[model samples]
Target: MSPTPSHSASRLLILITAGFGLALGAQAASHDDEHASGAHGAASSQEEPKVIAKDSLKQKMAAGKAAAKAEKSDPKAEPTSVSMAELRDLIDQKIAEVRAKQAAAPAVKVVNKSPKPRAVAMSGQVKQSMAAYGAAAVPGLPAGHDLHWEYTGTAGPQSWGQLKPEFKTCSSGTRQSPIDIRDGIKVQLEPIQFDYRPTPFRVIDNGHTVQVNLDPGNNITVSGRRYELVQFHFHRPSEERINGRQYDMVAHLVHKDAQGRLAVVAVLLDQGKEHPMVQLVWNSLPLEKEIEQASPVMLDMNLMLPEQRQYYTYMGSLTTPPCTEGVLWLVLKQPATLSPYQLSVFSRLYANNARPVQSASGRMIKEGQ
Candidate 1:
C-alpha cells in the first residue's frame, strides 16, 4: 500500500539518525584501535632501546620522558609510530660499536722501580788468610772474623794496627816490608834458585791488588830453605827501594814451605819494554772488582824475571795485615821493564798500593851475586 507523506518522512528521519549513530561509533572504535597499537609499539621500542643502550642509560631515560610528555600534551596527534624490531636492531648496533671503540683504546704503561747493582767485594777463605797475614802479628783473631782495610782513610795502612787486635804487629813489628835499601851489607849471598815452570793461572782482583794463583809447580831455594810458590800479586810504585829510589811497580811472588814458612820475591817493575805476560794479565782483568777469571794459556814465571838475577835479601813481615815476622824477602836488584800502557792499567786500579818504607831498625840487608 502507498503510505502518507508525513509517515514516510518520519520513518526516513529515524533510519537516517540510527545510521549516523552507528557510523560515529565505528569511527570512535577505529581511533581507539590506532591509539592502542601506537602505544604498544612505543612501549616496545622504549623497552628494547633501554635494554640495549645500557651504556647510555641516563640519556635514553631522558629522551623517553620527553617523548611521553609530547604524546600526553597532544592526545589527537598521530601517536608517534616506531618499529619495535628495527629499534632493537639499531640499539644493538650502537652498543656493539661502543664496545669496539672501548676495546681499541690504548693500554696504560707501568714503570719499574728497582735498585741498581752494587760493586762486588772480596770474600773468600784465601783472601781472608792473606789479609790477616798482611798486618803485623797479633793475638790470633777469632776464626772468620774478617776485617776490612783500604789504601786510604781510617782503615788505611797507617791505622791498620788499631783496626783490630790481630793487626797489632803492624805498629810494633821491627822487621817490616818495603824498607829503603840505602846501604846493603856487600856480602856475596847465594843466588835465588828459581824452578818456575809453565802452568795455567787464575787471576783475581782482591780489592787490594791483582793476584795470580798458579798450579803447584814453581819453587825457589833461598839460603838453606826451599819455598814452594803458591801465588803472586802486584803493588803500584815498587814496595822495596834501591838506594832510596822507587820504581814504577813491583810483583811479589809469595811462597810457602813444608814447615809453613812464608817467602816473598819482589820483582821491581820499571818503565821500558812491553811485557807480554803483563799485557795478557791486564787484558784478562775482570770487569767487576773481587771477581776471578782463569785462562788455559800456560804462563812461565821465569819470563817475568829480569836477565840479571842479582837480588837483596832481608827478614821482613808481610806488606799487607797481621804483618807476621820471619818472612824471607828477596828484592831483585835489576827491575823488569813494563810498557807505560801496562803500568797505567795497574795505576788506574791502584794509584799507589805501595806501603811506606819502614824503619830499618838496624836490620842487615844482604846483597846477592
Candidate 2:
C-alpha cells in the first residue's frame, strides 16, 4: 500500500532530524581536534567543518536506506526514516498531483477573428476566350507597340514625328495638306470626271475615324490621269480651311493610279439638312472599334458629291502621319449638308478628330472657275 502525503512528510522529517544529530556530533569532534592541533589546524579547521558535517549526513542517509530495505522485507513493518530515493519519489508524486488538479480546470476557447472577403467566380470559357483575344488583338507585334498614335494625348499629332522615324514627316514635311487655301490663282482647271457606281461598302470605327471601305469598280479621272477609288473617311471640323473659313466636317475620298500615284478629293460638310449618302454610311456604323461592318445595299458615290463640281485644287501631302508629298488634292468649292442629329452622332464618337491646319509655305493653290 502507498503512504499518504502526511505519512510521507512525517518519515522525511524523522530522517532529516537524525541526519542533523549525526552532523552536530561530527562537528564537535572536529572542533576538539582543532584545539589539539592549535595554530597549524586553525586554517584547516575553517574548511574541514563543512566537509565533515556533509560526510556525517551522507553516512546517516546510507544507514537509513539499509533500514528501509530491511523494513520492506518484513510483512508488517512501518517506515521510520525515509531513504533519499523514497523522498525523491514522494516529491515527484506531489508534483504530478498539482499538475493533475490544474489540468482538471475549465478551458477557454480562443477564437480567430477576421473580415470576410468577396468571392469572384470565373468560368472556363471566359478564361479561354480572354487568352485567345489577347493573342489576336495585336498579332504582328504580338505585344502592341507603345508608339501607337492617337488624336489627342502624349501620342497626339504634335508628338507623331518623335514617335517613329517613318512618321517623322508628320512634323518635318514641307508640303503637308489641309493648309488654309488662301490667296490662290483662280483658273479654269481641267474638270474632275467622276465614274462612281452603286457599290457595296464596309464601315469601321478605326479608333481614329469612321472609315468606309468600298469594293473595287469606282474610279475618278482628272487631268487625263485615271485613279481608282479605294476607301474614304470623315473628320470633324474639316482638316482643310477655305479662304480662312472652316467647315463643320470633311470627307476624304482616297484614290490610287496604276503608277501608284494618289489623288484625294475633299468634300466639306456643314450642319443643315440630312444627307442620304452620309446616312447610308452611318447606318452601318460598327459597334466595336477596329472591327468592320458591311452595308446590306450598295452606295452610289455620286450622292456623296455636291451639285456644282468646281473645286480648289492643290499639290500637297497626306494630312495624317507619314504626310508624304506629291498627292493631288481637290477640295470641292460647294459644301455638303448633314443634319444636326447626324452631326451629333459623329460628334459623340469623335468630339474633335481633325488635325490643325498646316503652313502653306508659299505653295500655289488653284481655285477652279
Question: What is candidate 2's lDDT per residue for 1-369, written digit by digit as tens?
Answer: 456644755576466555555555556567676676665656554656666656866775566566666756776655433333466455456446645654654432211211211111233322222221121122222211232777799988888778878678889888887799988899998889999999998887766778787888999999999998877888898999988889999999988777656789999999999999999999999887766687998999999999999999989877666566778999999999999999999999998878888899999999999
How many clashes in each candidate? 10, 0
Expressed as tens digits, the lDDT of each residue in 85-123 for candidate 1 is: 233344455546645654654431111212222111222
Predict model 2's lDDT versus the native.
0.74
Single out the weakest 10-residue window by summed lDDT for candidate 2. 110-119
lDDT (Cα, 0-100) at 284 in candidate 1: 74
Q: What TM value does model 1 have? A: 0.62
TM-score of 2: 0.60
Off by over 4 Å in 1: 1-145
In model 2, residue pairs whose N, Cα or C atoms come closer than 3 Å (at least 3 residues apart or on different chains), thus clashing, are none
